[model samples]
Target: MSLKSFGAKIFAKNIRKKIDKWASKPEATQKKVFQELIDKAKDTKFGKDHDFKNIKSYADFSKKVPVRDYEELRFYVDKMVAGEEDVLWPGKPLYYAKTSGTTSGAKYIPLTKDSMPSHINAARNAILCYIAETGNAKFVDGKMIFLQGSPEMEEKNGVKLGRLSGIVAHYVPSYLQKNRMPSWETNCIDDWETKVDAIVEETRNENMSVISGIPSWVQMYFEKLQQKTGKKVGELFPNFDLFIYGGVNYEPYRSKFENLIGRKVDSIELYPASEGFFAFQDKQTEKGMLLQLDSGMFYEFIKADEFFDENPKRLTVGEVEMGVNYVMLVSSNAGLWAYNIGDTVQFTSTNPYRVMVSGRIKHFISAFGEHVIAKEVEEAMQEATAATKARISEFTVAPQITPKNEELPYHEWFIEFEKEPEDLAKFSKTLDESLQKQNSYYFDLIEGKILQPLKISRVPENGFQQYMKSIGKLGGQNKLPRLANDRKIAEVLEKIIKA
Candidate 1:
C-alpha cells in the first residue's frame, strides 16, 4: 500500500481507540470535566476578552450577554469590508466562509485561525462519538471522501493558498491528512463546479470507504457514480462504511440515500460554523449530540421568549434546563464576545451536555403573523409527514402575499416526494391542516383569509439539488431557507413556486 494509505489505516486505528475513551466515560464525569473547561475558558484571553468582566458567575455571564442575531454580525462584516475594525475584532480575519441565508445573496462570515480549532476539534469528536456509539472502528481503513468546497484559496502574498479547505487539510491529523482530495494548494480558488467535477473524475476509480460532507452533494455524486458505473455504488466502493454530514437537517434526504445505497448508511452529525465547531453527533445515536468544547469558549443561552428582547435573561451551561428552547451565544478564541449566531437549541441531557439544534431564529414563516418559529415548523412538518403517509424527499416553506392583503399570508411549499401518494391533493391539504393545528395562529390566518391556500410543488426529479447548484451552493451551509423576508426574494420564489 502507498504511504498515504498506510498512514490512513494507522490514523483510523488511533482515532477509534481515542473515541472509545471519550464514549466510555459516564455522563456525570463528562459533565464535570466539561464544566471545568468552561470555568477555565471564562478566565482565558478569549473568554475574559468578551464582556465577561460583568459575569461573576455562570448565571451572571448569561445575564450580561444579550442574545444577538446574524444581522448584528452582518453589521460588523459590512464594517470590516469597509476597513473598520473596532467592533469586528482585534486581528486580521483569515477568510470568510460564504453561507447561503434566507435571501439569495450570501453572507461572508469571518473565520480566523482562532476560530478554526473549535471546528477542527468538534469534527474530530463527532467521528469519535460515532465510533463509540456503533462500536465499529475498522470501517475507515480505505480512502475517505469529503465532498466540501474546493481546496483553492485566492492568491495572497504572491502565492495562492486554499483558504478554509486548505486550513482543514493542514489541521487534519498529520497521518490522515494525506488522504484528502486536491493535492495542489494552488488549485484552491477554482469555483466549486470545476472543483467538484475534477473530484468526481479523480475519485471515480479509487477505493473510498468513508464519505463526508453535506447530504445534497453526496447524493449528487452518488447519482453521477451510478450513471458512470452502471451498477450500485456498493459494487464500486464496497468498503464505504460511514456517511457523515452536518450543517443542515438530515431528515427528508435520509430515505433517498438509503434506497440508492440499498442499505442504511450510518451518519454522524457535525456542528461547525465559520466561527467555531460547537458540537457533534453522539456515538449512541445518529441524531446530533452537542460536543461541549468548554476549553475554547464560555457559553450562554437565552430562552426562546427571551431571545430578542432588550432586557432578556441568558442561561449558562450550568443553569440550562432540559428540553427548553434557547438561543445560543458564544465567546470564543476568535474574540466574538456575546455573539449569537441565531441558532436555537434544546438540552438532551444536563450531565453530559448533549443538545440538539432547534432551528434558526430567522428561518420561519408567519404568514398569519402568528410568528411561527422554526421549531414549530419542524414539528408541524414531522406531524404532516407522519399523517399524510407521504415520504418527502426535500422541502422548503415560505409565506406568500395574496392580492387580498390578508392578515395571515399564504404558505408556499416546495417539495420532492419519494413515491406518488395515493391521495396527493388530500396529502397536501392534510399537511396544511397539520401546520394549522400545530400552530393555531396558522389556522386563524387561514380563517381570516390573510394567507392564501397552501401550494405544493412535488418536483419532477432532482429539482432542489439543481436549484442549489445553480447558485454555487451544494454542500454544508445551504438549506432551503424559510421566510423569504427580502423584497427581491419574492421575485425568486415566483419562479420556483408551483402547485
Candidate 2:
C-alpha cells in the first residue's frame, strides 16, 4: 500500500475507537449531552432572556422558550446583522449562513464560534464513522472533491454572508486540504456553470477517490467529467469509491447515478442544513442516519400531524418513538432558542436514534384534503420508475385546484426524464397507482370522485434547471421543492418548458 493510504487507515482506526466509546450508551449519552449544551449556553443573551438560569430541566426549558420559526426570530437576527454582540449567543458570530425562508425572501442563520465546531466536527466525524464502519480508509488518501457553493462571501457590517457549504470550505482541515480538489479561485466563481467547467478542467486528471455534494449537482459534474474524458466515472477516476451526498433524497437519482458511475460505490448521506449539521449515515448496516446527539444542540420534536394544534406535545430525545413523523425544533449554542427549522423526520430506530428525513413541513400537497408528503411522493415515483423501467432526471408535484364549477381538482407532476419510458400513459398510471396505494386519503379522493386522477406533464430537458435559474435559485444548496400546495412552481415549470 502507498504511504498516504497507510496513514489514512491508521487515522480512521483511531477515529473509530473514539466513536465507539462516545456512542457506547446512546440514550444516557444523549441526555448528558443535551444537559451540557443547555448549561453552556445558559449565560448567553438568549438564555438569560428566556430565564435559562432557573431552567433546571428539559421541561423547564420547553415551558420557558416557545417554539419559533424564522420570522419570529428575525428581530434578533437583524440585530446580529447590524453588528450587535451577544444578541443571541455570547459575543458575535463568525458568519451567517444565508438560506431560503418559507415566509420570507431569505434567512440569515448565525454561525458562532460555539456552534461552528458542530458543523465542522460533525462532518468530519461522519466520514470517519463511515470509514471505520466499512474499513475503507483509502478514500481519504487520494483527492476528494466537494462541489460546494461560491466561496466568495460578502461582508455585511462585520459579518460574512454565504452558503453554508462555502463557509465550511474555508475551514477544511489543513491535512485534508492538500487532497482537496477545485482551487479556491475556481470555487469563487459565482456562476455555477462556469465554476463547474473550471472544476472539471482542474480535477479531471487528479487521482480523485471521494466526491461529495448534492446528488443533482454532483450528477451534473459527473456528466461533464464524462463528456470531457469520454469515459465512465470509474474509468476516469479508477480509485473513485466513496460518494457523500445530502440536500435532497437520493432514491430518485440512485439508478441514474449507478449508471453514470459504471458501478456501485459506498455512499453516506448527511442531514446538514444552514441551521446545523444534524445527522449522518454511520453504519452500512443501519437504515437511517445516526443523530448527532453530542453535537452542541438540544433537539425537540413536535408531531407533524399535530403541529398546527393549539398546543402540540413536544418530545425530547428521551421521549421520541420509532415510526412517527415529527417536525424538528432546536435550541443551539448559535443563539437559536426552541427554533423550528421546518424539516420533518421519522425515526427508524430509537435505541441508537437513527432518523430519515420525511419532508419539509411547508413543502407538501393537501389540496382536496388529501395530505401527501415528500416521502410518499418520492416512494411513489420510485415504484413508478421501477415498474415502468423509466429513468427520471428531476421532478416536482403541485396541486391543480379545479375551476369553479369545473370537473375536479387533481395533482400535476412535472417530470424531467433522462430516458423516457416506452409508454407515457402507463408511466402516469403506475405513478397514480403507487401514490394511491401509499396514501389512503389520496386513494379516497380519487375513488370518491372528489379529485381527478393525477396528470403527468413531461418537462423538457433541463426544464427544472431553467426555472430555478430564472428564479435565481439555480445552484448550491437550493433544492427543487417536491410538492407545492399551489401552482406557483408548476406554472414556472410549464412556462420554462414552453419557452
Candidate 3:
C-alpha cells in the first residue's frame, strides 16, 4: 500500500473505535446529547420564548415545543436571514443550505459552526467506517471525484447561500483537494450539462479511484466517461473501488450502476439532508443504516400513519419500535426546534437503532384510499424489473383521479428505460401484481373495482431530465419526485412526452 493509503487506514481504525464506543450504549449517549443541546440553547431567543429554561426532561421539552414543518418555522428563519442576532441559535449562522420549497421559491436552512460538524463529520465517518469494515483503504490514495453543485455561493443578507453539497465542496480538506478531480472552475458551472462536459474533459485521464454523488448524476458522469474512453468505467479507472450515494433509494438503479462499472464495487448509503447528516451504513452485514446518535441532533419520531391525527403520538429514540414507519422530527444545534424534515423512515433493527428511508410524508397516492408509499413503489419496480429482464432509467407514479366519470381511478406510472423489456405488457402487469402484494389496501381496491389496474406510460429516454430542466431544477440535489399526491407532475410529464 502507498503511504497515503496506510495513513487513511490508520485514521479509519480510530473512527471505528469511536463508533464502537458510541454504539455500545446508544440510549445513554443520545440522552446526554439531548441534554447538552438543551443546555446550550436555553439562553437564545427561541429558548426564552419557549421557556426552555425549565424544560428538564423529554416530556417537558415535547410539551413546550410543538412539532413544526418548514413553513411553520419560516417566521424565525426570516428573522435570521434579516441579520437578527440570537433569533434561533446563539448567533447568526455561518451559512444557509437552500432547498426546494412548496409555495415559496426556496428554503434557507441555517448551518452554524456548531452544526457544520454534524454534516462534515458524519460524511467523513461514513467513508472511514466503510474502510474500517471492509479493510479497503487503497481508494484514498488516488483521485476521488465528487460530482456536486457549484461551490460559488451567493450572498443573501450577509449569509452564504448554496446547496449542502456546494457548501461541503468549499470545506474539502487541503490535502485531499490535490487528489480531487474536476477543477473548481468546472465545478462552479451553473448549468449541469455544461458542467458535466467540463468535468469529463478534465478528469477523463485522471487517476480516479472513488466517486461520490447522487446516483442519477453519477450515472450521467459514467455514461460520459464511457463515451469518451469507449470503455466501461472500471476499464477507464482500473483502481476505482467505491461509490457513495444518497438522496434516493439505490435499489432501482443498483443493477444499472453495476452494468456501467462492469463489476461490483463497494457502495455506501447515506441518509443526509439539508437539515443534518442523520445516518450511514456502518456494517456490511446490516441492511439498514445505523443512526447517528452522537451527532448534535436530538431525534423524535411520529407514527407516519397517524401523523394527520390532531394528537399524534410522538416517540423518542427509546420509544421507537422495529418495522414501524415514522416521520422524523429533529431538534438540532442548528437552531431547529422540533422540526419535521418531512421524510419517513422505518426501523429495521432497534438494538443499535438502524433505519431505512421509507418515503416523503407528502409524496404518496391515496386518491382512492389505496395509500402507497415510495418504499412500496421502489420494491415493486425492483421486482418487476427482475421479473421482466428490464432496466429502468427513471420512473414516477401519480394518481389518475381526473379521468372521465366512466373511467375508474388508478395510479399512472411515467417511466424512462435504458433497456426495454421483451414483453412490456408483462412488465406492467408484474409491477401491478407486486404492488398489490405489498399493499393490502391497494389489492382490496382492485378487487372491489374501486380502482383500475395501474397504467404505464413509457417516456422518451430523457423525458424526466427534460421535465426537471424545464422547471429550473436540473441538478445539484434536485430529484424527481417518485410519487405525488396528485397529477400535477404527471401532467407536466405528459406535456414533455407530447412535445
Best by TM-score: 3
- Candidate 1: lDDT of 273? 70
For model 1 the local lDDT of residue 296 reads 57
Please write out the lDDT profile of model 1 over residues 160-225, one tens digit for every residue. 333354456556676565555544542353555555566667777887778887776677677777
| CA RMSD of each candidate after superposition | 5.2, 1.8, 1.3
Q: What TM-score would each prediction reach against the true structure?
A: 0.78, 0.96, 0.98
> Looking at model 1, which ten-residue stretch has the lowest summed lDDT?
155-164
Candidate order, TM-score descending? 3, 2, 1
Instruction: Give the alpha carbon lDDT tens digit for every residue of 1-499 in model 2.
Output: 6676677667778876776675667767667766776777677667778887897877887788889998998888888899888788888889999887766877899998988998998888888777666767777778999989887788998899898998999899998889998898888888888988999999989999999999988988988988899999988889999999998999999888888889999889999988889999988888889887777777899999999999899988878889888999987878888899999999988767889999999889997778799999999889888887888889999988864577688899999998888788888998899899988999999999888888888899888889889888777777888998999998888787777
lDDT of 2 at 239: 93
**TM-score, model 3 to reference:** 0.98
Residues 325-416 of candidate 3 have per-residue lDDT tens digits of: 89999989899999999899999988788999999999998887877999999999998889888888899999988687689988999999
